[model samples]
Target: MSVQIRNLQSEDVLTYSLPLLLGDVRPPLAESKISVCNRRNNTSMSWPVYNGTFKALVELKPGENIIELMFYGEVVELVLVYKVPPLTRFVRPVYIKCHDDPHGDFQGPEDEDCSAESACQRIALGAKLIQTLTAEKLAEHGFGRKTFLLETDLDAKAPACHVFTSSLSVACAQQMTGAELWLKFACELMSAKTFTQKENCKWFCFMSFTRYEAENDSLPKSHIDVLKQTKGYAALGGGGLALFSTGNLHCWAETLDQVPLRFTDTRKIDRSKFMDDSAYRGFYWANYSTGLGSSLHELGHTFDLAHTRTGIMARGFDDLYRVFIVRPLRSRASSCSRDSSRLTTPSPYSSRSRSRVASGNSIGAEPCFLRPLPTRLHSQPSFPDVIHIEVGFAQLPTKLTQCYTVHHYDGSETQTVVTRQSDGTETRSQLTLSPDGEWERKDVKINQLDAGKTGMQVTACRELPMAPSALPHSAVDGPDSVQEFVLQGQTPSDAGAHWHRSSAVILNYHKWFNEDCEKNQGSSPEITGGYITSPCGLRLIELRNHDNGTVVHHWEFLHDDPPTEFKVNLDKVKDVLPADCVECSVMVEDSRGNISKKKVHFDDL
Candidate 1:
């Protein structure tokens, strides 16, 4: 018997192909999922081909195979083509559901077989459905600093945490080795709670997982529930909160074909024949555990330690024992060449828990419940009332200390000032009080002090805490440390471009001008990298101390690169310089830089 098959003629097939066309890119009409159908019988077709081109394909029977192509959702374009194969291959109806984790309902079903010509239509529809679904999910979360997302290589069982101001999210799966490192360096080490007067810090966190785990693993549910219970952990850091509604976290999951974050690639760690493979696997396992340990060992880095051969906090460990025992060195010298005596000796004040602590001394836990406490929710109060006054300064022989009272209406004002100290104290400062000195008594009541109508600006007297008779002398100061670089201008009318200025921008500017630029207005500035799609056609001028403390240097205007001119813009640079000298510059290719100085003159606006 001879097998004879031929393309189904339009008359023989119920399904007829309609050309897919692009529509105006309206919000609702931007994309969609499509189902091919037969106009005569109004029956749907199954198994349409999906190609990115303007064409779609459907299978048809031996005779007429013409099918009407129907679309739902938004249409970004009208120039679509239908690429149907020869008739005789008609299959069952295709499911018309939105591409959801579990999928959602499409507009309708079709009776006609999917024409081979509908492949482009199918592909376009699938792509549009995916993008639509993903975008809708991302929008549910504000996608702001309060909520962050991370795409990581953490495995299904790995633990992850997202730190936010009002929200927190913990990953359900066990953590990957690098993810553990990120938790230590990004979460535990750099968190604001790890520092005193955390006002100087700002951070948001997120841990991502592979799609298979996010969808199938019950971890997000369990972990998010755990995070929901962790009020104690959340309260420790004002910005700490948890959320598990997956949008930003799961967007990538929808695109990937049910793969783990590292599914496409697995890290190949070089193992030695001299070492046991199980033991080597144990090394990774131990690292995962130790990472959890480091999360708990939140010790603020007050020590200037470095990586030594065999110390906790050292760079590499010989085996699992060292991974648990050693940590990253805090002191620059702590990890340097040393004998066994110097290797593991504890300080006089060292305790068991203190030995392995990270920089903040914060202890982390598996997201869990907290004992409900009747405490006030300390949220940001109304904008703080700031008062500026010239107070008397008493100079000591070694360092000068200034004391002044700023009356607070709500008594919620806080203070943090950098004091000049000896070496090893750059990261911290200690209040030096005499044994006989009154610590609490030193806090003056603003109401009791004599004052002007606005406030009291008193001549501060310097008295020795140790010896009252000793006169406090001031260091002969030269330059005004408080400097201001103003960036004030209207955002261009064409607001299509992205503009992001992080606090790091200020840090970069400090590096740009070095000490010559002095202090910026306020402790930090709000403005950062400036961007625009349309040119406003404006130039910037940099202002410096123009004194003995300042040395003018040549700079240039640059975009996405370091300046090559003799002047710089405080508002334009994307990054900060690493060093303090003008000649000591950031790489042109790298955003790290000594940010330049730019001031808004009365006319620049």
Candidate 2:
């Protein structure tokens, strides 16, 4: 084979994100075509090498799987193991409708199907895609492919995304703010005994009847600006809930079969084909990247992940396609905007940022609301000449070992969480889930079972058969709120020199446009800037013109007890960046040698 696989070994074990093919190709043979065939499942996937890289979501079966990839007249065989994720807590995908529109039909371009059934399929596909991305990212971070699972429908044998009829009216909801929409869903879902009882469950919800409000143009004989028009109110996440608008559902692929083509699809998002207000959806494929990536950002909040200095938590999910596809089919990246995640807060773990914001924030008309990981194995002597080598079976990544307390029938209590230290902050060591596949969360509202039946992998946290005491009970019957389940995760063992990171952030940035002259945004007061926060302290932060690879701004922080986090401003980048530059990339490195790099399009400011 002229091209070698850079990210994977011959035989590997994968816990989640089944049927996935993610790796890089050796250069020179970069753009050549590669054909991937799964012998056991009789499945075929093909993607052209992209700039010395290749990534795709493929198909596979349980247990031992054989895959053959051929390129440049050479074939490479690979073997891997697929272990289903044993996560008990899951994010339930749901489609809600107003009483008047029970079918839950969403507004969209005529060419697209917006019916309830179609919506369910799209939702299921999107949820699975998210699951795959999460697992792949966790693996990339050396976390061993741990991720949350999605509820499954027994009858359909698919993702269990049910249709919910909300009591609110279309008119009432449209007039309500984003905060109202989120609260409604949280409260309504909580009304179910199952959801309220189980603190582990989270929800991903969308409404069916949010229509675009066409704004009238004031200029005589002038047409309305397509970008100015806004849609129904919805965009919030936190405390076991993630709610969003269905404006971009039309752009989502209905099944995994449609993703490969959808990744490379570049059809212009004209009003004739798309039901949207933000021009950021530059093309059809972008609809998938922005929607899915942004969804990951909102969902991150439900998992207790905070807004970081960069990546999905910020404004960088627009390139989510890069995670699935090495690069875009056509270069429309610069034409796109940061509205994909709709995060409006001053990002980069702002030390002063609000702690408990409910609705979160927004980008353009697209708002990304909030919210809000993982441990040390052993200590190594700081000697300069010592080397250690130990090989053994890899353990699964950190699970929510235990997060809350469970009161038994007798005078005994079981505190389900194991506490640990994470960068000076105390955190919970979670259940790493059940072997039989029943995991956490009572959100299903269906059946009940024990830890073994439900798949709750008992770690050190489960305190069973506690001796009964005659003294009066001292434990509280319940928690103050479901938010108590929102825990700060532990750092992975291998992540010793790195922070507790999830999904290696999506590469985020905030573009500052000059109001006086949109074309002259380069001269804006603040060229571009974002938030930065790290526990290990910062080593360096660099901003460069991606087109020419010229350094535009650079900073180095050297201190013992460094401030938690601070803002990053590139106000002087125009002095060094080429006037014609289209995009730039930001690279941040922590004191522990871990680095994060992401590219953004735009020049001048």
Candidate 3:
């Protein structure tokens, strides 16, 4: 059998379709597989074949991408190079309206208390902030600045967009999920055709004001789910951005399909806090007079920029002027190089045979650089050693009690508490610490402290044990360093007699460490010295029914700590199957970046 590539030229491009054709492919081809490996990012995608043809969307990096096509036992390699294009600018219209008023009558922009001039000042300030943060800096990297135009109708009885009413109470406003509200607004815009059909203008930004009170509010999980579901909505083709004004003390933002939807609390703004050279501060200035700092930060996330140590992307909304002038655009080459090291390693239990593919061709066999894993786990499993906590005040009338809930990076939690008597005496409780030497404090009371204020401190440390095994001196074993584990399953006692009634299956996994290998140390220097700890964090768990090769449930945790055990729910599986659907498989991965697989029958689980 032979493979061919189509719809590809030597010129630079943004995205393209990678099509492969299989000719004279024989029967046992059921075992045949097709994979596309991106050498630049060290990422790969498996293409499913239909009618001897396979096609997949290939988004290219800024530079060259050495993509390898492997079908059956043959491997064909080619280079798809991309060059940075000229910066493209986009201007999205903004709409503002107040949904609710805590006092009595609602006021439009024309009202003396809510004048159009005042709204214009805030909108213009936000625009200046965006231009200062992006404009020239991003233009150098082939990315353009996104500006907003406030479209206001002050003379009209009703605003351009109706702002739904919400109560001022935090609980009342929070009960209405931001995603639902954002979706409602987006659907209205979609129906209005607010987004043009221009391909280049894919991003739309919408700004609105609400009378709801907010304090350090975070978007609900429903927002993330909405973004995941309606990632690329309507004519815009890309998700949109929304900035809502609530009387919140702080502002935050999140991405929906890389589109940033940010919320700013206008009540928290203190114009006095705006400093011309304040961007150099380590903490964000949440009290900026114009409330533009947080707005810029949220917009940065839309560009995939992360928090840095000393830039606009850094924590703390303070020092905007300095951040824009001092911080340089992140180097693409360095970021890509770093990501290439942690590219998803092949799983040993994956059905696609890597052994044959690895030996069949010498095209892309070289191993990329791998960072050393951590020796000891910490509060942040991804970090070698670090702890994060929040401290605040609470009041109690009689005996004051404070509870601490410590969370480990590995998805485990422990709790501790302290109490103060009415007579001013304090009692401390020992904390249940994780083996990784990390703990968190929770439910603190302001009146419980010895001084009747928020003042408390605790310190503890332990010597970590030596490495379990010595590091190897030679070349490390690539992705196949560890062997697969045997997965055993059992039917839940709660499973009803009817097949449809059974919603979940119990899964038990053990034998994580190899019997012959040292428990504390990794097998190779690459594994031992990598950013991961000895008992690698659990990365992924997937359950698939064997009858028709359909996946029933899948869970993946990246960067954050992974769960050691999983309870798989089968209610989402739509396929109708017989009671004897026996062939089922489970896949798992550990913090050490190794994947394993196991198979079991329905009777076994």
Candidate 4:
């Protein structure tokens, strides 16, 4: 029973102060377990070796780390050196608390620390998890494990609390939509002299004041469909910021050791105790992943990464724990395929009557009187521990080989592990998947809006009002909405292009831009049907379920080309729309940096 570190080029490695995801040796010994001891911290834990592989997150210390891998009886020692990246850019983990709210408490149960300080710690840890995931993914794509840095205090202590008091009353902020809150926070942080010294940086902002008003939440009478509305919270990423709420922060683990146990937790969520802002992903762990994973997805947006067909950039985030822990997402599958999608992370981890002490702190969270897990989860364990190894990592961006492959999608590709030549030396020619198998990722180039250019043009256009849209057809006629409308685009080569004729013409966009540009808006300008100086053309369009913040599809306009004359017509997308697309959002940015994000409901059509 033996498992060893398989991918690092050397036992002595230089790395970031993030979670070290150690993959098992290929054709692993037996399906047993291994003991990992971090000599620096004297923390040791047993990790299960599932299938032909096993993986675990080994925490590293700054400067130097001595990690011991004890397999059954044999022991292998590996040395790792940790260092903060020299890059100036970083992702700041922040918490936004409401003004005049003394408690500054986030949503959580009795034993949990829902205070602003606790929220900062949780935010910092969650930020590292996603940051580690990003690095592992980049390494998987053969990018040498590159990732952004995290901002720390002068003392270099982190999960550092960067608190901002909202000018809006606690009640007002609590009532604002995720978009509204995100916009407000982005505005405040950018203008803050204390926070803006860094010329270019991104943020993982957390809202500590959001809460669900269950009193007004009217779920249908059917007890089977008891999901609630997730207002006042958001899971969006774009521009240089990713925003979310602490409503579900309680589901996240406070310490690293608690991560694995948290992922496999099968307890039912008591809404009063644990806020399931994630709606259907009602388990304690699922909510943890939903909020954390969705936030990472949005952070990808801030990086200017567009959605790919798969990987974390898509919906492959459900099993981030699988990358480190040998546990399946304790989902309950029913005979009804119709409900299978809704049944992810379905029930309690086990049906066996275990003592209530299993829950050390969450009192009575898994009482038998409460609902049970899906009856269909194989009690005997017929599935391979690694079958769901991704959430299975066997996927990609067109190219693949025994080892490495490059992708055209902005340098994104599946990670390829190195194999040994007969001499025991490594060779890139012998590329292969990790002992745990594969991981995939792809993203489009994200670019910041040229707000300076936009400003100069806006100033010039202030005296010259933009012409009303010269669209062949108008798909917008109602409300003066910032996030409701359709968009149409065409290549200069395609003179006959129309929204209904080509997919390249219609989609959506939700973006983040400097608030400074917003103040210079043209007089009487409107984004939708009202007025426009210049149709800044389309740079990128994303199709997503805004409610959950899942980006469905992404379209990018390379070479910075955008259509000069476009239209908003939902009627054109009826036949060519993507599956399950009930609606689409569109944002039109004029020369003045004035952007109008609009939505078109297929139901209305």
Q: Pick the candidate with the highest TM-score.
A: 4
Model 4: lDDT to the true structure: 0.53
Poorest 10 consecutive residues by lDDT, candidate 1: 461-470
Of 1 and 2, the candidate ahead on TM-score is 2
TM-scores across all candidates?
A: 0.17, 0.52, 0.27, 0.55
Could you tell me the lDDT of residue 357 within candidate 3? 34
Candidate 1 vs 2: which has more lDDT: 2
* lDDT value for model 3: 0.34
Model 1: how far residue 137 lies from native, Å? 27
lDDT of 3 by residue, 1-605 (tens): 66666434434242112212222223324323467677777766554443454443343455677777777777776676543223222324343332343332212211112333334333443443344334323322222222221222111232322233232333333344455555655565555543443232222332333332122343212222222222111111114443443222122211110000112111212212211111221111223322455555544433222333223433334433332211123333433232322223332111243343333321122222233344564645453655766678576557777877654333345776778787666666655555456754445443334442332321000000110111111132223332222111222111111001000011111111111134423421111111122245554444556554333443443334444443433332223233566556655545543445466544444
Q: In angstroms, how far off is 441's CA in candidate 4?
A: 35
- Candidate 4 local lDDT, 1-605, one digit each (tens): 44566655344554456556466744554455667788999988665565546666677777678888887677878777776644445778888877788657787665556687767777878877776765554444233555566776112754465887777777788577777877888888888776754455787888877675454444322112222334457677788778886777877766665565666555656654345634355577677776787777677767555454345555556545545455322224322222223223322222231122233333323212222264675677685565543344664434222455543222223444444433323333322333244543432221224435445443332212111112223332222222212222211111111111111112112122222344344532133432222445443344445444344433233233443443445453343345567776543443333444546465543
lDDT of 2 by residue, 1-605 (tens): 45565556667776544445765555544254577877888877566565666765666566777888877677878887765544344568888888777677887655356799888888877887777766655554444455565665112253468678888887887777778788877888778643422464678887787665454533111112332344464657767788887877776766554565555555444443234422244655677677777777788766544444335555455656666655423343224434333222222112232121112221122211111101244655565865886789686544223377543222233344543332222344333233234445332221223444554433112211111111111121112100111112422221111112322321111110001223322321111335555555544455666764333444444334434344543443344456676667766655443455667554322
lDDT of 1: 0.22
Query: Which residue runs does candidate 4 get wrong by more than 4 Å?
Result: 12-15, 25-33, 153-159, 216-231, 272-274, 277-279, 328-605
**lDDT by residue for model 1 (516-603), tens:** 2232222211112221111211111222222221212111222333222222243322122213323222111112222232322212
TM-score, prediction 1: 0.17
Q: Residue 258 of candidate 3: its Cα lDDT?
A: 8
Clash tally, candidates in order: 117, 35, 27, 13
Residue 564, model 2: Cα distance from true site in angstroms: 19
lDDT, each prediction: 0.22, 0.52, 0.34, 0.53
Deviation from native of the Cα of residue 101 in model 4, angstroms: 1.7
